[model samples]
Target: MVTYRSAGVDIDKANEFVKFIKEKVKKEFNLEEFGGFASGFPIKGYKKPILFSTTDGVGTKLKVAQAVGVHNTVGIDLVAMNVNDLITTGADPFIFLDYIATGKLDLEVMKQVMEGIIKGCREGEVILAGGETAEMPGFYPEGVYDLAGFCVGLCEEDEVITGKEIKPGDLLLGLPSSGFHSNGYSLIRKVLEMNNVSYEDYVEELGKKVWEVLLVPTRIYVKEIKKLKKNVKIKGIAHITGGGIPENLIRILPEGTKAVVYKKNIPQNPVFSWIQRLGNVEEREMFRTFNMGVGMIVILDKEEFDKARELIPESFYLGEILAGRKEVEIL
Candidate 1:
């Protein structure tokens, strides 16, 4: 007689793995009263509070983690993808929950994954309230795992920074990215493998193993942007991800206001160039798939440019909002 364990799922091992992660997971909790049936938050003082939430996954970048046998940083990617989006609406991320599904239980791997999640949550100033981990034998391949995260944040209704305030003459400020933050991997993997390049190989420009460049953890922009929000009048915040500059930035543009991006003014990271050459990818396609060095953008009136500049020194004047169709143009 065949059993679930024989089919590559080990129920006992999966339960044991959860038991091991309880301690590590508890480290993200700050509640003094620990025995609640549901996650709790105390909201008392705000006159008008607005709640913001988002859910996201790391995309096919998990395949890169599985390829390189690096399980931890992907967990950070999982959290960063979700919480970063929550902050775009000027929300203060308050709590996060994760979902992990795998073919079998690997305690060591799960521990490292949880550690990264906890570290990411702490950095974002949010609580890791709860999560679910599932082991499905027939569903996933052995050694492969997938992760997704849900985030909730709070802000006052009047304080929400929707793009409604954006108008012509507003300055666009870009924040530099460490590298590609969990997008465009399907094409990247295809090109690299076709060229017989392995993660172990070092490219001169990257200055480390290829996998290191591929696995650069996604940047958490919540802290920096939160600081800027306090002192600057930000009209809109755009988190550059899968849709790249034009598509992503235009999401927050008000109708009749187009964002004119000066391509020359935008900085290009070497990895982007390398990928372009390797994949023979078109410039337009590259802009649509990757962050292309600028990971997040802030839009505010031209009058606030100098003040906003002081708050975010790394930002660059990418371009301006103009009275035109709701489109992004490269000048």
Candidate 2:
């Protein structure tokens, strides 16, 4: 008879790993029905609520973590990847689940990963409802794993912040990024290799090791955006990820409106300038790939500028919306 273990898949080991997580799930999550095929999340009281969800991975940030021997923070990166997108629609994320695939199951490493996930969940105010762990011996290298997460949120139909309300006179307010919030790492890795710089090398500009700079977990903007929604007439929000400010901003822009982001106006981290010169990367490529500094873009109505300014007093004046076609331009 054919067997599963011979095919490099460990079913029993996966079960044992889940066994370890279940006890903690009950104690920490109050989840009695933990190990079922699907998880149950209890949410209620949505009068005209619409559900929003997103699935995302941390990209090559995981490789940076592997090269640095740090796994904890990437779990936060994983959670941030999904929940940040959910918040773009002005929805409150209620629950999230993770998928972890590995060549081998290292319980210690897995535990550390879970630690960051729990921490991220607390930051986003979302529960870690359930997750899956798979061990495929040949698929991934030993001591390496990949993580992705799915997040679901709820918001009233009328409360959605779609950029349809954006107009020519609107201003774009940008929130500062902690670092390269979990995107462009593949190119970053390429840049590193081209420069022959090791992850352990300390760069004076960053005042830290290379891996530490690259592995900084993505910021979860769920709480901040929700707070701003209460005080400001936020026409739309763009979670700057892989596409950076230019691509992500356009996602929410209404027709006949163009967003012009001024490069000099953004508060940039020194590391970006360092990398740009080192990699010979152009400005448009920098804006398209890395966040360059702005992690989240908030489009505020001209009338609500004062109230919004009061809220994010230090927000960088990225640019203004202008009457044009549905597109984004860097000024």
Candidate 3:
């Protein structure tokens, strides 16, 4: 007689993992119940609320985390990717859910990942609603796992920033990224392999080991955007991710307006320069692949630029919008 445990699927272990998640959510989010089929929270304070949802995964960056035996930061990356996108519409993310899957259960690793998730939720002011932990025997390797996150946000109907307000003469403002911010790791790993570089190896330019820089948790822009909203009238916002500035910035432009960005003013982070030197990557490819440095771009009227700058001192004056075909130019 074969049992589920004998077949490498331990129902008891999965139950225990669910209980573990419940405890974490209870402590972190002050929830009285968890492990439910669906999670929810009541909404308030908006006379006319519009709901926005976003889903994203950490992508190949998870492989790097597994390689380095660090499972925490990627949880933050998961939340950052989703919440940042939701906020572009001027929504306040209120609830977040996560999904984790692996070939076998590892309690300790899951716990560490959960801790990072809780931290990220707290920082983003999102509730740890609920999540799923699947242990699939044949689908994944024993030590490898994957993560995906879902975020829901609420905004007033009149307050939604649809980018329709963005027009010619609006100034582009760029907020610096924490690092790579969970994109382009496939190319990064390939570059490392071609250079015969190890994640443990330290490079002089970046001032840290490869894995350390790569593992830097993506910055959550919720607080900064919220603060800026109070003082500045932001016409549009873009979260720079896989497609980089050229692809992301163009997204918020109106049909006839174009964006012009000054590459010289981008304040290229050291890691990008290192990757370019090692991989011999072209400038265009680099901009299209990585954030280069800016993580979030905000569109504002020329007159409001001074106030927005005063609020976010680290922001750089990227460029201005102009009348043209819908596209982007990085000079």
Candidate 4:
């Protein structure tokens, strides 16, 4: 007779992992039925609540974390990616769930990853509702795992920002990013590999090792967006990801209006310059691949620009809308 354990799946280990998670999050989050088939969260305090949901992964940035033996920050990256996208719709994220899969469960590494996730949830003010941990011996290589996160948020029906009000003469404001926030690492890895550079190698320009820069957790803009919306009539919002500014920002532009981003206005991250010099990447590709420096963009009326600055001192004047095709231009 064949047993389930003989097939490489360890039931006892998975049970223990679940128990560990419950113990860590029991006090922090008020999820009484976390281990059940599904988690529950009560929604209240909205006149006409609109639900928003998003899911995202850490991308190849995971490789850098694994290579560097840093497993914690990637969990934060997972939460940031999902929550940041949810906030782009001007929603308040209230619950978060994660799925982690590995060949053989490494309790210590998974624990570290959970810690990071908990930290991100706390920072974003989202509840750690529940999640899953899958252990398949033959499915994934030993000591290797993948992570994905799901987030649910809600906003008042009247408060949803859909970029319908965006028009010519509106000003664009940008929130600076924390290095390359969980995107374009595949190209980054390629650049390093082709040049025979290791993640452990130090780059003087960046003042840090390669993995250090690569593993920088993505910024969670939930709080900042909430603060700005109360004071400014935010016409549009964009979370710069996978496709740099042009691809992400264009999604929020109204018809007949285009965005022009002044290169001079952008405070480019040093890592981008180093990558360009090392990989001989074109300027257009650099802007297309990386966040450059700006992580989030807020579009509002020109009259409100001063007020926005007072609220977010770190935000810079990015560009303005123009009467043209619905698109984005990085000058």
Q: Estimate each model's TM-score.
A: 0.94, 0.94, 0.97, 0.97
- Per-residue CA lDDT of model 2 for 187-234, tens digit only, reads 888998999999999998879988878878888887788889888777
Q: Tell me the lDDT of candidate 4.
A: 0.91
Q: Which ten residues in a row have the lowest lDDT in candidate 3?
A: 33-42
Q: Ten-residue segment with the worst summed lDDT in candidate 2?
A: 22-31
Which clashing pairs does model 4 show?
none
The segments of candidate 2 whose C-alpha lies over 4 angstroms from its true place after superposition are 1-13
Looking at candidate 4, what is the lDDT of residue 25? 82
Q: Per-residue lDDT of 1-331 in model 3, one digit per residue for the tens? A: 9998887788987888788878878888889967778876778788999999999999999999999899989999999999999999999999999999999888889888988898999889999898888888989987999999999999999889989999899999999999899999999999999999999999877889999989999999999899888898889999999999999988888899999999888876888898999999998999999999999999999999999998989998988999999999999
Question: What is the lDDT ranking, best to worst?
Answer: 3, 4, 1, 2
In angstroms, what RMSD does candidate 1 have relative to the true structure? 1.9
* Candidate 1 C-alpha lDDT tens digits along 1-331: 9998887778788777656556665655745533334577788668899998999999898898888789889888888999889999999998898899998878788888888888888778888887888888778888988898999999999899989989888889988888989899998998898889998999998688889999999999988888888888889999999989888998998899999988787777899999899889999999999999988899988888888888878778888999999999877
**Of the candidates numbered 1 and 3, which has the greater lDDT value?**
3
Task: Flag the better candidate by lDDT, 1 or 4.
Answer: 4
**Residue 308 of candidate 1: its Cα lDDT?**
81
Clash tally, candidates in order: 0, 0, 0, 0
Residue 190 of model 4 has an lDDT of 93
